[model samples]
Target: MSADTADGDGSEEAVADEETAADDAAADTYTVAVDRDACDGVFACLVRDDRFREDDDGLAGFDPETADALERSEASVQATFTDDRLEDARAAAAACPFDAITVETQ
Candidate 1:
């Protein structure tokens, strides 16, 4: 038996292209977390990852924790990222001498 494939609009290629685009748009997302308890304020994370930076008390990553304590303490600071910045975020996590940074991907 022969396969049956037909498109009245004759835009099969266009349909396939749209599907591919959708897949790309659904790329993985990531989040970064820093534990002030584990951080040493070495600034290694700031140097290694563009997403990280130095704050008043110490190094602060993007999308820091929402808790009011985050201003005084960095125990549970967090950051979110997409495919484009996932690598940078991970690098920052790895650069933490105290292993304060944590990268979570979905």
Candidate 2:
């Protein structure tokens, strides 16, 4: 009933909310892919998502440190992630001038 007790209750609720958010983020999964044949090394995706980086061949690739699973081939690169950054991946896909980037929820 006191102001101090109310503040304590609010703080506990805030922590619980944060934990729920983290759990939701961990449950979400998605995949991002880059078509090597279509990509022109414009780096447009890099600006929207730090997870997208330039590879040794001067094309778009995924940052291994950020990706939960990464696969690279002669024609494309794909990365799977389980996090709350799906919108960031979508933004990068939408920013690609060559339509080389793709993001899919999994």
Candidate 3:
């Protein structure tokens, strides 16, 4: 997915960044999910956003105060934000090398 920014002549073009591509493809509908079972307790996602935190068991979990506790067995919707934070959210997904995090958009 790529975006087309208008130039002097007003033409469309494609961008290379996947994060921006995803955002451009789906502007309003997007969410991020994390699989607790698949989470390796790595703190990479936590560092990237306020959405994730270390649970009592030292595993990656949603920040209790900032987020509602999501289901652990499946893809848990962690956080929702405006377009400005979309890139940061995408970075969080990428930070999880274990592939426990997933981003949903239409």
Name the top TM-score candidate. Answer: 2
Each prediction's whole-model lDDT (CA): 0.66, 0.91, 0.66
lDDT of 2 by residue, 14-105 (tens): 88899988777665688999999999999989999998999999999988999999999999999999888888888999999999998988
lDDT, candidate 3, residue 106? Answer: 40
Off by over 4 Å in 3: 1-29, 64-83
lDDT measured at residue 104 in model 1 versus the true structure, 0 to 100: 73
TM-score of 2: 0.76
After superposition, which runs of candidate 1 have C-alpha atoms over 4 Å from their true positions? Answer: 1-27, 63-74
| lDDT by residue for model 1 (1-106), tens | 6556664766898889999997786555766778867777787887777656666775564534322122333366665555555666678778777888887776
> lDDT tens string, model 3, 1-106?
4555465542333443665777665544456677777888878998897777787777777755543234453434465433445566689889898988887654
Q: In model 2, how large is the Cα lDDT of residue 21?
A: 88
Q: Residue 24 of model 1: what lDDT?
A: 84
> Could you tell me every candidate's TM-score relative to the true structure?
0.60, 0.76, 0.57
